[model samples]
Target: MTDASGRIALLRATIVVVAAGGLRALTYRAVAAEAGVSHGLVRHHFGTRDQLVAEAMEFAIDESLRGSNMLEQGLTASEFAAGIESLADRESALQSFQYELLLESRRRPELTPLAERHYGAYREAIERQLGRLGVADPALVDLIWFALDGLVFTQLVAPADPAPALARIRSLVESAAA
Candidate 1:
């Protein structure tokens, strides 16, 4: 395959794998079967399962980044609530992919460091926002982090809407600040 064809192939395979959800032990054969391509083609682009997963996870992250423009500006209290809403939408697309990556990382310790790095960037962004607000409570910041994770999980699992949760968090943060 040409370079463009190879990238399109991987992109299609990634979409299938993500839609399949939590395919922890998925092989190149599985991906190739889904993509209707030869197994060798899958292996050609992603040499190992880890490499495939990494690329898939990166694809999900890139999708998540699509809606983060609102956060580029310094987030005020209300703006932060909107950011959470945007992020919840983003997380919904990639939650299963994230879950599988984390589970797979247990056996493949090499991937653990990459996970940490991804999570560290998440924490740092939150910390930077808190710093902008002049909040000194590391404990509170941790609570917000936990709350955000819970929000993502809730949005993923429950049938309820996220607007109420987002509103409640906004109120909580505003009240705490006041």
Candidate 2:
């Protein structure tokens, strides 16, 4: 793999490693084994473990955004969180990786800013979609983000059908718009 692709691969491997075993399991050797490369390759790309975590978190955020409709403009209530279950199911590890980062930030002061920034980006995307639905209330937007966040987390821990809960959220948004 080229430098860019190799770096991306390592980042993905990092996500998988952290997702499965949390921050304690994030070692260069583990990531290298996951990516089928040498530990030196992981070290060469990210000089420190902190750098690896930060970069991997960024890559995970990009993946989450690409898989979500939160950033899309002009989406209807019915379209909100459509296929969210499948997306969550398919990207379970990716979602878990982000959650791990969120939890780790509480323990590591340095990671707090990065976690907040990345999480704010998701909240903002959801806010934009809410705006398109004619619900511009900041509190309501925050509530929606929380609900979506909760749903995603619940699904991660114990797989459940999210359709009904999402339907309720959609109805609430539609009523708020009305």
Off by over 4 Å in 2: 81-87
Q: Tens digit of lDDT per residue, candidate 1, span 15-131?
A: 567646566547777778777788888877888876787777766655554455323556676666556552556555466566556666788898786577556655666666666
Query: Model 2 scores what on Cα lDDT?
Result: 0.84
lDDT, model 2, position 17: 97
Quickly count the clashes in candidate 2.
0
lDDT of 2 at 116: 89
Query: lDDT of model 2 at residue 21?
Result: 99
- For model 2, how does the per-residue alpha-carbon lDDT over 3-55 read when each residue is reduced to its tens digit? 99999999999999999999999999999999999999999999999999989
Model 2, residue 96: distance off in Å is: 0.8
TM-score of model number 1: 0.72
Error of 2 at 50 (Å): 0.7
Return the TM-score for each candidate structure. 0.72, 0.90
lDDT of all predictions, in order shown? 0.65, 0.84
